[model samples]
Target: MLKSMTGFGSATQEANGLTVTAEVKTLNSKFLDIYCRLPRVYSDKEVELRNLLTQRLERGKVELSLNVTRLTDIRPGVTVNRPLVEAYVNDLRNTSQSLLLDVSDSDLFKLALQQPNAFNSEVSTASETAASDWEHIQLTALEAIRKCDEFRQQEGHGLESKFREYIQIIADRLTLIEVQDVKRIPAVRERVRNLVTELMGSDEFDQNRFEQELIYYIEKFDISEEKVRLKNHLSYFLEVLAAEEANGKKLNFIAQEIGREINTIGSKANDASIQRLVVQMKDELEKIKEQTLNVI
Candidate 1:
């Protein structure tokens, strides 16, 4: 039931000659982030719209946009602030006369206020609903968002399966190391015996001192503790992955722990087989770590 933090949704509604629509898309993020683009008149609805999005989403960088059209008996129209335009024209003419400038007939003032935003009128229609009956539009938008979440779930399931596969590979490699390390301790003991015998040749090296030094040297090279801790970390990582939420950061931390233990084991293990297993485990772990960066 895990979900990724990336998705897309869009919905449209038409009510009594009023059409409104909403679209949302998201990307993975450590926290819940929202950006909205709404029409100027409906700017007041921003808080309510954000609340609706937060209800369904827990974490991600989300972008939302709203589009509205009026489809009533009324027709789209434009209005111009004639008084402002005339005032600018009169002021410019007076300035030109006072300065004695030989300028041509000017079209600057007329051209300045011609755009939709400069003196544009608000949308109005036979529909009484705000921004073309947005109630149904809100519902449609929510449904689209739900579908988006479903897709995220499907994708997250695939990632979960891949995680299990790589972790299993690492576990199998660890098992190989465990089996081959049995002879390593015996080999170290024999080498210690040989070195002591050579050093004491007719010189009478102390047996007690030699035994103590041998114990210290073998224990220092032992990777039993590292192996046990590494196994425990690997188990914890799998458990975290199964949780029903966005655990990307938590999973990354667990992977770090696993890597630390693996490196420690690699450095301490003196046997060729153990070293080979360590390399294999590291390769698998690195792959898992790379894939985890894309997880939500």
Candidate 2:
């Protein structure tokens, strides 16, 4: 089954006064490469997210992002250290008296409390509401991933159909090449006889030597073996396409082999008719190669 490597999906949810949104994007790649942008609270979940993506998408560059927002009333309020504020106030008043720096002042106490570190707090901690909020976030994220996978599958189906059509085109061209090849034997034999007659010129050529030399020349240019291997490669290519596996790279390699064989046949064929047929066959195979780029 062929699957294209481009798709998108997103899911969002709000519950327990927290909002979570997730989106995933995929692009063509030789291997599964997953990247993530996640909230600090959910950073620990990156590995699980990667695994989930790898399991669903056999190969691609994937990006998954999770964003979390806290509602105002549910957030953790600020913290103030009353003991520390009091100590600062006492120390400042004593220092002022010892140094005779400042006159008595009630407003000074308020100024001391306003200093830095007098208060500290994490504004986003969920505390009692953390689990419920996390649950909603997780559910939404999973839904988004599922939708993305569905999109990939549908796109894959379209690519699969195209691959099948290209494979058929290659098979049909192979038939033409085989037919042309069969006609080549008779043509080569006739040409060999004429060449012998011309070269002998008034003296009969030795039949045994002529036969041996002719055999050697024909064997040197024969493309029968290459054609046989190409046909076999095409058959296996179709077989792998039918199987439920990640066979994109394997199919590409097979396609290279097919191209190699076609090249050998093109170069070896010397007849004008066969050369024209080879051109047509090459055109068809090139189309297959172009379409194979989308396989995943």
lDDT of each: 0.77, 0.78
> Candidate 1: where are CA atoms >4 Å away?
74-128, 196-212
lDDT of 2 by residue, 1-296 (tens): 56677888999888766788999998887778889999887888788778877777777888998989877665336777678887878887888889988745576577677888887675455454666676787788788888888888788787777777777777787788788878888887787788778767747668787788778768756888987898898888888888888466887888888888877888887767767766776776677676566567
Instruction: Compute the lDDT of residue 116 as modeled in candidate 2.
Output: 80
**Best prediction by TM-score:** 2
Summarize candidate 1's per-residue lDDT along 43-72 as a digit string, tens digits: 888888889888886678988888878776
Weakest lDDT window of 10 consecutive positions for candidate 1: 123-132
lDDT of 1: 0.77
Per-model TM-score, in order, reads 0.72, 0.74
